[model samples]
Target: MAKKMLRSVLFACLGNICWSLIAEAAFRKLVTDQNVSDNWRIDSAATSTYDRGNPPDFRGQSCMKRHGTPMSHVAWWVTEEDFTTSDYILCMDESNLRDLKRKSNQVKNCKAKTELLGNYDPQKQLAIEDPYYGNDSDFEVVYQQCARCCRAFLEKAH
Candidate 1:
């Protein structure tokens, strides 16, 4: 009887290991595959919708809230999904890159990238900054970086 119980426990352990491996493979596939052709990826992230949280059911009304006061809204935290999904995850600045990497296993893939939509370059390491708290001129700086990085990404993503 003890032998039979030991065999049963061994079978359960083997089943669990196989299941875990399969789950891990599925997760890795989700992170690495860039199936989307477009550059913009908007999902429920820290900045998108936060603390108030979302109801499992939207019901008749919406529980969603604004991301702070538009111009002042600073929901800039990145999620694992961002790194996993973006064809080329672009960080506005070194700080943003650090935050993104902290939530990622793709630290090797994370880089100081701009979010610029067009007019960019390669072989350059420029970090873009978010347009917040700083002077209006700072926003332009952010714009330039974003434009350059985005342009570079667009040129390369295809």
Candidate 2:
């Protein structure tokens, strides 16, 4: 018998309060539901320090609750260590992708492959827009997008 390798993933957005948090929660649910939670490491961070150390946005939290997804992540900014540690550095939109790429470039021998989480969307949606200032309905949009993209990504990963 051989031990399985564990893959790590870090999701990111501009502030880590909405889009990224939703994506992280969605991905976790997928992995857990598939009974592969032990095979992966998952977390999320912000490309900027805008909401560092804060809880996820209220509307995003409410949206997750409505969908029965659990999220308890405290906001944090992306670090050089993340570039080296995660196998995949997935982000919400173009701005996050750019920021992760730039930060990864600064780390010698960066190991993570940073990409837009929406790149895996079966519907070909290329960006997951931030819903920070939007209403609950906007948060619902983000949730739906994250669910679709995360499922696609997980299926491809396996």
lDDT of 1 at 106: 52
Q: Candidate 1: lDDT over CA atoms? A: 0.31
Q: 110-152 in candidate 1: lDDT tens per residue?
A: 3323242222446364544333345445544443343344445
Q: How close is every model to the real structure, measured as TM-score?
A: 0.41, 0.97
Task: Estimate candidate 1's RMSD in Å.
Answer: 17.7
User: What is residue 52's positional error in candidate 2, in angstroms?
Assistant: 0.9
- Top-scoring candidate (lDDT): 2
**Pairs of residues at least 3 apart in sequence or in different chains that clash in candidate 2:** none
What C-alpha lDDT do the candidate models reach, one value each?
0.31, 0.90
Per-residue C-alpha lDDT of model 2 across residues 40-122, encoded as one tens digit per residue: 99999999998889998989889999989988988999999998889999998888888888888899979998999999998
